[model samples]
Target: MPKPTVKVWMEEGVHSAIFAQQAVVGVFKLPQVTCLCCAIGLPPVHPNVHSTQKGRLLMSSITSTQVVSLSSQAPRPLPFWRRWLRKIEWRLLLLPVIGLLLWQGWVLLAESGYYADFIVPHPDTVWARLQERWADGSLVTHIATTLREALSGLFIASLIATALGYIIARVKIFDYLLTPYLIFLQAIPIIAISPLIIIWFGSGLASKVVIAAMITWFPMMIATIVGIRNVSTNLREMMRANAATHWQIFRHLEIPSAMPELLGGLKIAVTLSVVGAAVGEFVSAREGLGYLVMYGRGISDTPTVVLAVLMLTVVSLVLYSLVAMLETSLLSWRKAGKP
Candidate 1:
C-alpha cells in the first residue's frame, strides 16, 4: 500500500484550505486525490463541486476540514453578567433575604402602632443606634473585646480538646474513665454554673475566657475522638505491617483521615465560642457587646439592644465563614472527591 503524501504550498489565503484537505483525506481514506488548484495557488474551482468525481471528493474533503476547524476552536465565553450569576452561591442567600423581608414587615406593623417602640423597635431605629455607636467608637471597642475573648478561648480549647481526644481515642482505659465526666459536663447548663465561675475567677477577663473555653471544648473533643477512631482499619494494619511506630502511624495515617472531621468540629466551636463569650459577658462584664445589650435593656433602649444582637450575629457569621474558608483550603481533597 502506498502511504498518502501531504504536500504543502505555503501561500497567502490557502494554508487552511489545503491543511483541511490533507487531514480529512488521510483520516477517512476516501480516495488518493490531490487539489491541484490548492497545491498550485489558483482560485477555488467551485463552491459547489458535486458536478464530477474529483469535484465531489474536493468538496467533501473541504467540508470535513471546516467541521474539524469549528470543533477545535475554543468556545465563546459567557457574558459578564451571566458569569457573575453562575459564580454566586444563590441558595445561601435565600435565608437572609427571607429574614430581611420578615424584619421589614415587622417594622411596617410597628409603624402602625401594633407594637410599642420599647417592645419591638423599628429596623430604622436599630440602624440609627448602630450608626450612633459606630460614630462614638464604642461599637468597635465592644466587638474587639468580645472577639478577643472568643478567639483566645477557642485557641486554648482547641489545644486541650485535641490532646484529650487523642489520648481517649487511643487508650480504652482513658476512654472509659473520661466518658462519664464528659457527659456530666455537657449535661450541666453553663448558665447554672456561670455565677460560680464568676465567683471563682472573679468578674474579669479570666472568668470570661474560661467560660468561653468550657462552652467550646466538648463538641471538639467528641469530633476528634470519632474522627481518630473511624480511621480505616486497613490503613492501620498496613502501617503495622511496615513496623511503623505509634507516632508514625498517628502522624501519617490518623491525622489526615481525621482532618475533615476536625475542621468540622472547629467550625462548630468557632460559632459556639461567640455564644460562650457573650454568655460570660452577660454574667458579669462592664464592657463588650453583651454588656452593651444589658445596659440597653436596663434603660429600655430597645434599638441599642437590637443593634448589639445584630453585632453579635455578624461576629458569629464572620468567624464561621473564616473556619469554612480554612476547611476548603485544607481539605480540598474532599471537594475533589465530589462529583
Candidate 2:
C-alpha cells in the first residue's frame, strides 16, 4: 500500500502537515484544490477569492483529518465590545476632562499668587461673597439681566443673519456686493471698539444687541452661501421642468436643503452672541454676569468671579444645546430617507 497522500497538522502540537499534503496531492491528481479547513466548518476565505472548476473538485476531496487539523489553527479575533471601546472617540471625550482640569488649576494658581490680591478675593473667601450676594437677591438679578441680554442678542442675530445669508446665497450679485464688506467688518476685533460701542449706544441694551449681531452675522453668511449653493442640480432642474416659480423653488427645495448648515452656523452664533453681550456689559453696565465678573475682579472676590464665570458657561451650554435639539428635530426627515 502507498503511504497516505494526506497529512494533518495543528500549530499547538507536532502533527504532520496533512492538510497541505492533501491539498497538493488532490490538485495534482484532479487539477483542483479547495480549502480543507472550510470543509470542516472553518470560516471560509473572503468572497473575493478566485476559483476554477478544478480547484473546486480538489477542495471537495480533502481528507477529514486534513480538514480538521487546518480548522484548529483558525486565528483568534477580538471580542466585539473590546474592539468598539478601543475605537471610542477620545478627543471628544477628553474635552470636558480638559476643561475641568483647567478650572481646578486656575483655582490652585489663584490661591497661591501675589497677583491674587488684585485678581480676586482668595478662592476660599469668594464663595462666601457669592453666598452673601445670592442671599440679598443681587446675584439672581445680575444673572437674569445678563442672560436676557445674551439670549435676546443670540435670537435676533440668528434671525437676521439667516435671512440675510439666504438672500446673499440666492443672489450672486448681492453676495459679491456685500460679502467683502462683511468680511472687513468681521476682521476688526469686537473688544477694540466695545468701549466705542458703549460710547455710541451709551451703555444701554441697544449697543449689546449691535455687538452680538456683528459677531453672529459672519458665520451665518458663510454657512448659508455654502449650503444654498450645495443644493443638488438635479433637484433644481426638476423644479424648473415643472415650471415652478423661483419663490416656490426656494420655499420647497432650497431652505430645507440648507437647514443643516444653517443650524450649524446658528450654534456658533449662539455662543459668540453671549460673549459679545457680556463684553458689552463689562464695558459699562451695572447689571449682568459680565458686570458681576467685573465687580468681583475689582474687589478681588474670587468666589464671586467663579460664580459669574460658571453662570456664563452654563448659559452658553444651554443655548447651544437648544440649537442642536432644533437641528435634530428639523433634520429627522433627512435621516429617515437615508439607507
Candidate 3:
C-alpha cells in the first residue's frame, strides 16, 4: 500500500485548514481520495473524489463521516446568539477600554503636578461634574432641550428635502428652476450665514431648528435626488404599462428602490442635525449642551467643558444608533432579495 497524500486548504479569516486524505490505488485497487468538509449549519460529510478513470477524472460519491467533526475540534463555532452577543460586547468594550487607560494615564500625570489640572483635568473631576449636574436636575433639562431642537430640525429638514428632491428629480422644470438657488445656498457656508439666521429668526427655539434644518437639508436632498434618479427605468416603464398612478408608483416602486440611499443620507443627517443644534446654541441659546460647553469655557472649567462635550458625543452616538437600528429593521427586505 502506498502512503496517503495529504491536501490542505486554508479558510479565509478563520484560523483553520481543511485537510483531505488522498489514497492511491496500487497493488490493492483502492478507488479515490476521501475528503472531509464541514458544511455551514450542517453536519460534516466525506466525499470520495477520484483523479483517475478510463479517460477522465470525476467526483465519485459523498457519504457520512464515521467520526471527526472538524468544525467542533478545529474551528469551534458558537451558537448564533452567543456569537452576536460576543461581537457586540467586543465592539463596545474595545474603544472605551483603550480610552479609559489613556485618560487614566493623563489623569495620573496631571495629579502628579506634571500637568496642570486646569489643562488636563482629572477624570474624577469630570465624573464629579456629571454627578453634580445630574443631582441638580439641570443635566436632564439641557439634554431634553438639545434633543428637542435636534429632532425637530431633523424631522423638518428630512420632510422638505425628501419632498423637494422628488420634484427636482422627476420634473425637469423644477430642476432647472431650483438649480441656481440651490447653487447659491450651497456656496454660502452655513456657519458664516448662521449669525444672520439667528438675527433673522430672532434667537429662539425656531432659530435653532432653522439652523439645524439648514445644515441638515442639503445632504438628504442630494441623497434623495440621487436615489430617485437612480430608480430603474424598467420599473418605471412597467409601472406605466400597468397604468399605475404617480402616487402608487412612488409609494410602491420608488420608495423601496430609493430606501437605501435615503437611509444613508438620513444617518449622516442625524449626526449633522446634532451639530447644527449645537451650532445654533453656540451662536445664541439660553440652555443646551453647547451652552454648557460655552459657559464652562468662559469660566475656564475644564471638567465642565469635558463633561458637556462627552454628553454631546453620547447624544450624537445615540441618535446615530437609533437611525442605524431603524435602517436595519427597514432594510431586511433588501437582504431577503439577495441570492
Candidate 4:
C-alpha cells in the first residue's frame, strides 16, 4: 500500500481560490470522503491509504476562483422624476393629453367657421351652458336624480342576478329551465321593451329603476354563473368530505372563488346602469340629464345637449371608478399573495 498524494497548480494574480478533494473507497459499497483545501495550501493527507485497483486513484479535485468586478455590484438609483414617470398610471395620462390636443384642434377648426354652431358648438359655448345649468341648480338636481336611479337599479340587479346565477350554476334543472328565457330577455333590446315598462310601472322612479336593472342584469348573471362554476372541484369535494351542508359549501368554497369574475361583471354592470337610467329617462322622464338632452334638442340648444352628454360621461366614469376601488379593496389578499 502507498500513501495517496495530490498536486497543486495556480495562476498568478488570482485574488481568491478554493481546492476540494473527494475520495471514494471500497468494492461494491463505496463511501465518499471530501476535504476542503484553502487557496494558501493543500491539506495534509493520511500516510497509510491504499487503492483496491491497480492504476486507479479514488480521488477527485475541484479548483474554483472568486472573481469580483466593481461594475457588477448594485446599479445607481433613478432620478425622482424619472422613477415617478415610469409608473403605469402616470404613463396613462399621455392618452388624455393626446385627446386634449385633438379636441383643441377640433375647437380651432370650429372657430375658423368650418362648421355651424349646431353642428360643432364652440367649447366655450358648451362651458357657458354648463355654467348656466349649474348656477340654476338644474345640473345638480338632474345629476342627483340620475345617479340615484342608477345606483338603486344596480343594487337590485346584483341581488337578483347573483342569487339566480348561483342557483343555475348549482342546479342543472334550473339551468335548463331558465337559460332559454334569460337568453330571450338578453337578446331583446331594452329600448324596445322600455315603453312597456313605462306603461306598467308608469312614468315614475319605479319605471326608471326597473329599466336600469333590466339593462344591467344579464352581464352580472353570466359573470356569477361562470365564477361559481369555475370554483375548484377539489375544494367542493373536500367540503363534502367534511360533511358540510350545501349552504356551507357555497359560502366557504364558491363565493370567494367567484369574486374576481363577479367584480369584473359588476364593473360592466355599473357602467351600463348609467346608460339604462338615461334610456329610461328618454322614454319617460321630466327631470334628468337625459331629459335635459331631449329638451335641449327640442329647443335646438346644441350647447345644452353637449353639457348633458358631458354630465352623463362624468357619471359613468364615477360609477366605474367606484366599482374598481371596491374590487381593489376586496381583492387585496389576491394581489398580496400573487406569484
Q: Clashes in candidate 3: how many? A: 0
Point out the worst 10-residue segment of candidate 2 by lDDT.
44-53
For candidate 4, lDDT tens digit of each residue in 267-321?
9999999999999989889888888889888899988998999999999999899
Candidate achieving higher lDDT, 1 or 2: 1
Tens-digit lDDT string for candidate 1 (277-309): 899889889889888899899999998998999
> Whole-model lDDT for model 2 versus the true structure?
0.72
lDDT of 3 by residue, 1-339 (tens): 333432322233332222233433222222222222333322322244332223222333323222222333355457889978866756766888999898878778768887778888888989999999999999999998888999999999999999999999999999999978986887889888888988999777899899889989999999999999999999999999999998999899999999999999999999999899989888888899988889898899999998999999999999999989999999988788577
Tens-digit lDDT string for candidate 2 (1-339): 233344433344545333234242343332213333333334542222212334342334433333333345465556789879987977888899998897687677777665544464455565677788889999888878776777777777777777778888778898889888878888999998889988998887888877877777788777887889889999999999999999999899898988888888888888998898889988998788898889877886667787888788888999899998899899888787577
Q: What TM-score does candidate 1 reach? A: 0.74
User: In candidate 2, how many Å is residue 198 off?
Assistant: 0.8
Candidate 4, lDDT over the whole model = 0.77
Q: How much does candidate 4 score in TM-score?
A: 0.72
- How many clashes in candidate 2? 10
Pairs of residues clashing in candidate 1: none
Model 3 vs. true fold: TM:
0.73
Tell me the lDDT of candidate 3. Answer: 0.78
Q: What TM-score goes with each of the models?
A: 0.74, 0.64, 0.73, 0.72
Superposition-based RMSD of candidate 3 using all C-alpha atoms, in angstroms: 12.8
- Candidate 4's displacement at residue 126, Å, is 0.6
